[model samples]
Target chain A: MDIIVTELTKSFAGHIVLDRFSAAFPEGEITCVMGPSGGGKTTFLHILMGLMSPDSGTIKGVPSRKSAVFQEDRLCESFSALTNVRMVLDKSFDCGEIQAHLDEIGLGKDRTKPVGEYSGGMKRRVALVRAVLADSRILFLDEPLKGLDDQTKGHVIDYLKKHFNERTVIMVTHDKEEVDAFDARLVTLG
Target chain B: MISTMFRKSRLEKAGAVFLALAIWQIGALLLDRSIILVTPVAVAQRLFTLLPESDFTHAIAFSFFRIVGGYFLALLVGSVLAVGAGHYHGLEMILWPYIHAIKSVPVASFIILCLIWLSSDSLSVFIAFLMVLPIVYTNMLQGIKSTDEKLLEMAEVFRMSRLRKLKYIHLPHLKPYLLSACSVSIGLSWKAGIAAEVIGIPDGSIGEKLYEAKVYLSSADLFAWTAVIVLISVVFEKLFLRGLKMFFDRLERS
Candidate 1:
């Protein structure tokens, strides 16, 4: 089912952030929410992820099983990228298949090292891999390519589009090119 | 390669011991009073002389069991209580006053009170457990509280099982706290445990030997027993912590 946001309102200490905002995210499509810094884009995503509650609003049709690549990599620092990805996979998910996907994202060679030693872009890739590997009906990407260089970002975007074609994806980003690269329908927020 | 590694480590340890002995010898000479400060040589000689006696072994065993038993018991109970309190704030609130009281009360007062209610044989274990519970509880609770909420959120989203969450996230975060608690509390348990034993003077215990030494004015025996306690405490701490680290390492690899 497609997610529907109706009259979403949120505030922090009497400061309005998202005021009666409404939008709809269709299933099996990539939707990008773009805005200026401090424009409640992240707050909206946080509310969607159930990390926070809106003071007044209604969100409907969001999948119960969700995965996310948060703004921070949030990878387990002491675990390997392989281990991090494997942690979210079901028992039926094959290890060799996951390794092949990691290799496609340029993390195959460093699969054994702890994520703590990974570069920023590498860690981001690990987080992306973990999100994609999880068995979620919907995926959230919050500035998922923030730390990646242009070359890696292009490769990851291609991988994401190809693999997540049938899953609903809601992405929050400040970059216009990212919306273009993912072929996402743009939803602008003030 | 294995033999060479062992040899190198042995040499390094010996060097450290020699350096420490030199410092102690210099300090003892500066103090210049055997009553106030005994030299390493004197303590070693006293220990060597006491080694042959069966009573020495009996005393060591007696105190070692009680103190170590108390430490292990505290570890079990404290970890359970920490998990309980972590999961339920109401339980934490109820336990707050009792934990605070234990922390504030003096060890001597507790010992004296315990003497009235309990036999001297188990006094050391009770005291050691009391002293260690608060430390383990506080550290583990803080560790549990400070666990990465983001990871927990991820686990929830992915519908990870409780066993998986514990194995991957909770246990890893708790490792440092548990190790730190063990390092700090092992010595405390021994110190407080031995003190309780001395006050209670349970038969066939190190505390009894220490009290006997004090009554007879055998300063050498006293120093020797003190050294034995230090050695046992340090060795147990090192061994226990190493085992814990190895367990975690195995978990990580598997």
Candidate 2:
């Protein structure tokens, strides 16, 4: 089912962030939400992810099983990259499979080191890998490639495209190049 | 390389200890009064003579069990209460006054009051538990309170189960706080527990030996028992903390 948002409005401390905002995120398609900072892009993603409630409006069709690469890395800092990926996988996905996925993302050498010790780009990669590898009907990514270098970003985008081909994916970013690279349906918020 | 490093550290520690002993021996000789201060040699001789006595062994075992028991109980109860308080604001509010009361009250006063209500044998356990509970509770609560809100938000987004969130997120976040609390509380439990024993003078306890030493004016026995308490306390603290770290390591690996 497609995720439908109708008249969704939200505010923080009397400042309106989202006002009667509505959009439909298509199923099995990559959708990108773009807007200036504080234009309610992150708020919209948060509302859909059930992290925040709208002041007045309705969101429908969001799947129950969801995964996300948050605005922050949100990787378990004390755990290794492999362990962080393995944490979200179902029992059927063994450690070897998780290691393979991390290796594909260019994290093969740093798989054993805790993510806390990793560079920002490396941690971002781990977070992206975790979101894509988890079993989820809907995947949400907020600035998923923020700290990555251009070369690493291209590789991550390719990996995401290959793996998330069939899942409903919603991404929030300010970069037009990222949106173009993912070939995503575009939604702009003022 | 590792063994060499270990040997170097061991030698350094031994040299420091020897220097301390030399200072103590010099001080004792200058003081020239066994009543005020006993020499380390005298204390060691006293300890050797007392080593074969059944009472000596019994005293060591008795105090060790009560103090360590109180510490373990406090650890379990404090963590449970802190978790409850973390989950419920109302519960935290209710616990505020009790925790404050325990923290502010004097240890000696508590020992005396507890002796009236509890058997002398159990007084050390109660006192030790009382001293340790608030410390562990406060630290663990602070840890729970300071957990990353963003990570919790991520957990919600992923629809992770409660157990997974705890094992993967909460426990790992709380680790430093728990380890720190254990480090501080282990020594405190022994000190406060033994202080209570000394006051209550429980039968077949280190406190009783100390009391006998005082009554009979045997400074050697007093120094010997004091050394024994210090040694046992250090050994137990090292062992308990090691065990805690090992348990966490296994949890992380699994």
Candidate 3:
């Protein structure tokens, strides 16, 4: 099923963000949303993820199970990267399986260390790993690779593409390289 | 360098206390009166005698249990209420007036009014609870309010379970606020609780011992009981805060 946004309108105070914006996010495909700063790119994603409601709009086909990597890493600083991931996963998830997912992102060795101690790139990978590994119908990535160096970014992008396969991934970013890397369909907002 | 500075501070504190004690001894000697201002030695001696007395021990036990019990109860209730209000703005609005009233109203007034309503024996508990509630509630609410919205949004999108959200996000955020509130309110609870006892003259309470000391004009007994109260309050605060820190440490690790 496709997630459909119809004439989505949102305003903060008196500033218009999204003005009757319409778009289609097809099932099992990556849709990369791009825009200038304060262009409602993040707002649109937030609405799609049900974290925020559009002022006037109808959204359809958004699944109940959703996951996201916010613009900020948003990892629990005091907790281990593994523990932060485990908070979202069900108890039925095996520790070995979770470790394997972390290992895919080259974070297996320090999964037990507090994410507070993790470097910027390492933290981004942890957030990405957490989002991809969770059981979700749609994965929202808000600049998930924003702060990473080129080498780490390429590595994580590969791992992300592998795991995000055949899943509805809606990513918001300003990077055209990331869009081309994922071969994602682009939706520009103003 | 930090450890050396810490050691230096500790030594300075000890020297200051010693100097203050010496000044107090000289003042007492000049006055030549135990009834007015007794020497620290006299107070210490009185403490040793009181420690062996059944009445003194019983009073300590009585006041200790009620006051500490009241503080814990307030902590529990305040935290629950703060969490509730954090989730529901309407609930916070409803609780606003009462919280403000508790904060503004004089403790002595509450003690008197409560004495009319409650029995003398339970006066300290209620007073302590009343004193500590607003402090805990306000600080905890501030903590809950200041929790990172970005993290909360991530939690929401991931459909994180409530228990997990609390354990991973909320508890960590609340740690500093809870520690700060506990440190501050514990002493207030003790002071307010003992004051209530003093006014209510609850039998077998430290307050009653103080009252007796006052009536007999025994400054030594009065000073001794006062010192005992300070010691108990400080010790309890240290132990409770340490336990709270340990709990947070274990939570972060687990």
Most DockQ-accurate candidate:
3
**Who wins the lDDT comparison?**
3
Residues B132-177 of candidate 2 have per-residue lDDT tens digits of: 9999999999999999999888877776778888988999999999
lDDT by candidate, in order shown: 0.91, 0.90, 0.93
Tell me the tens digit of each residue's lDDT in model 3 across B118-206. 99999999999999999999999999999999888888888787888889999999999999999999999999999999999999999
Residue pairs that clash (backbone atoms under 3 angstroms), model 2: none
Better of 1 and 2 by DockQ: 2
In the range A1-190, model 3's lDDT, one tens digit per residue, is: 9999999999999999999999999999999999899999998988988888889989999999998898889899999989988888999899898899888889989999999999998998888888988999889999998888888888888988888869999999899989999999998898
- The C-alpha stretches of model 3 lying farther than 4 A from their native spots are none
Ranking by DockQ: 3, 2, 1
Best of the two (1, 3) by DockQ: 3
User: Which residue pairs come into collision in candidate 3?
Assistant: none
| lDDT per residue as tens, model 1, A1-190 | 9899999999999999998999999999999999989989989998998888999989999998899999888787888888888888887889998899899999999998889999999999999989998988999999999988888888998899878949999999998988988888999887
lDDT of 1 by residue, B104-124 (tens): 999999999999999999999
The alpha-carbon interface RMSD of model 2 comes to: 1.3
TM-score comparison, 1 vs 2, better candidate:
2
Candidate 1 residue pairs that clash: none
Q: For residues A34-131, write the lDDT of model 2, one tens digit per residue.
A: 99999999889988988888999998898888899988899888888987887777767878877888889989998998899999999998998889
